[model samples]
Target: MQKSDYFIKGILESDEKVVAKIYNLFFPKVLSFVYRNNGQREDAEDVFQKALLQISARIKLRKLEVINTSFEAYLFTACKNLWRRELNKKQKRVTNDEVKELVSEESDMAYALLDQERWELFRDKLEQLSDNCKEVLNLFLKKVSYDQIVKKLGYTSETVARQRVFKCKAKLIEMIKADKRFRNLK
Candidate 1:
């Protein structure tokens, strides 16, 4: 078994020792990250717990054959994403209590996980594109001007650059839509 699979199995089986080891091994880094990112100790604790729960829930809900990345890396990313979502919600809070809308924390976390999965799918699909297409798409995402793309890519004209961007984008969309996971995410 892969080294990471041990942890996945342990978590799935609720092995206490393995769980403790995970907390000892990863909690400090998560704590430090949250502290640096405008969160308190409590926030870090919450994020860490939620990340583990999300990972476990995902594994239970699907086969989760392989992590692709190391388990540590995957857990850290989930924590970072959850923390960022928390920060965003804070920023969007309504000052007036009466005007505040009710939102379920469970639903929010579920949505965050789904969004992360969709992003991962998109990224994998993007990596599968041709080098030229990847470069063009990256530049387009960064909002670079068509003239700049033309100059950088040695295209003859802005029109040519625009056409290339549109085609590449369409291909990317097609690839993303073709993935089965895309439907579940929606």
Candidate 2:
């Protein structure tokens, strides 16, 4: 089996030594990323734990497939995604004076899992596009100005950039919508 599969199996089998190795080998990178991304040490720790749990849950549910990247990359991405979700939640949180709704951990995990699925689906479809389409769509999605996109992509004019962005976005959406997973994601 591949090294990544060994880690996955360790996770699946609840091997303490393997888990410890993962934490030792990977957690420092996660900590660094979280620290750079408006997160504290505790936040990093929380996100790391949650990411592990998320992976565990996905494996148990048979939702995890191939780790197209390294296990380290996958874990780091999972942690990054969880951290981003946490940041968004924080931004959208009401003040202490306002009425607060209690959300359970399980519910939060469920939402995160579903959100991850949607993101993966979108990412996979995005990979199917031409390189030009990927670049145009990425810049467009980032809200880059048409002029900037035109300059960056060496387009003749903003209108051409706009057209390319529109076409690329439409193609991406069509591809995503054509996926069987799209229905469940929605």
Candidate 3:
């Protein structure tokens, strides 16, 4: 089903299954959108997720209603906005032409199909990471140091922390590579 249709149904009725299906359906589009826009599969996944995150935040805040557009357009717009913010976070300045060049392929279909495959592979791979790896990775992203990561994550030893980080990174790389998102990178 088209995710926008599914999502509007989910929102109107608050059906968990409908919501889950919407996530599954629209994520591929968002993933392809992100990857086509100077991001990796991971970035695509993240941008897609942030689209949902924004939805949830809006729901929680009860800030405003998305009244006019299909859920698909709203979702895609959210992803695009979030990615634009991410790119802006970079220190260097980027011109409008560069930004347009990055996402131009998303206006085409072939890139979209590849993105679908990549995100499905991505979701499956995340399920394979160890609990410890996931926890440590979260801490690392929080800007914690090796010592702080070990302490906060309850690792028995720093050696264990380092190994976990290394292994987690290796696993993430392998997962991304196998998914064809980072095949060109490695």
Candidate 4:
């Protein structure tokens, strides 16, 4: 196994010594990344923690496998993405020059992580909706047409399916907006 695979295994097993080694080895780079992106020491720490949590979650769910990038690179990219999102939440825009410095592949991995996080959040919120709403939204997410949804869900007509989808979507949005974690992520 590669050195990074050991780190991934360590993370999966929750090995404290390995985790500490990862932090000791990679934290400085992540810190510099956050600081360069208009963040402070505390912000860097927060970003690192969030990135670690994201990585751990993915590992536990078996979502991460055969990492193509170095572990440090993946972690740093995640930190950068998290910091960028935090800055955006505060209404700050990252400059084009800063963006240009990111490796395309690393940035793509970072974005995939961010997208997965958002999708997970949305899915959690979706589960809190009524059964009919969940059904409609799940079908909609799968690109099922309204006519098909009506047939599948036994709705009266395509118009009813559309209305249900609209209402369910509105509820889902409202639930997402009301979540404290959602606010924090934003």
> lDDT, candidate 4, residue 142?
92
- Best-fitting candidate, measured by lDDT? 1
Superposition-based RMSD of candidate 4 using all C-alpha atoms, in angstroms: 12.0
Tell me the deviation in Å of residue 19 in model 2. 1.3
RMSD of 3: 12.4
Clashing pairs in 1: none
TM-score: the better of candidates 1 and 4:
1
Model 3: per-residue Cα lDDT over 103-150, one tens digit each: 443332233333433443554466678887777777876778999887
TM-score for each prediction?
A: 0.77, 0.89, 0.42, 0.50
Each candidate's lDDT (Cα)? Answer: 0.89, 0.88, 0.65, 0.79
For 129-174, candidate 1 gives per-residue lDDT tens digits of 9999999999999999999999999999999999999999999999
- Listed per candidate, the RMSD to the true structure in angstroms reads 3.2, 1.9, 12.4, 12.0
The alpha-carbon lDDT assigned to residue 35 of candidate 1 equals: 96
TM-score, candidate number 3: 0.42
For residues 1-186, could you state the per-residue lDDT of candidate 2 as single tens digits?
Answer: 998999999998999999999999999999999999988999999998898888899888955878777999878888888899898877767445566686789999888888777877888899999999999988988999999998899999999998998899899999999999999889
Quote the lDDT for 68 in model 1.
Answer: 74
Model 4: runs farther than 4 Å from truth? 92-112, 116-186
In the predicted model 3, the residue pairs found to clash are none
- Candidates by lDDT, descending order: 1, 2, 4, 3
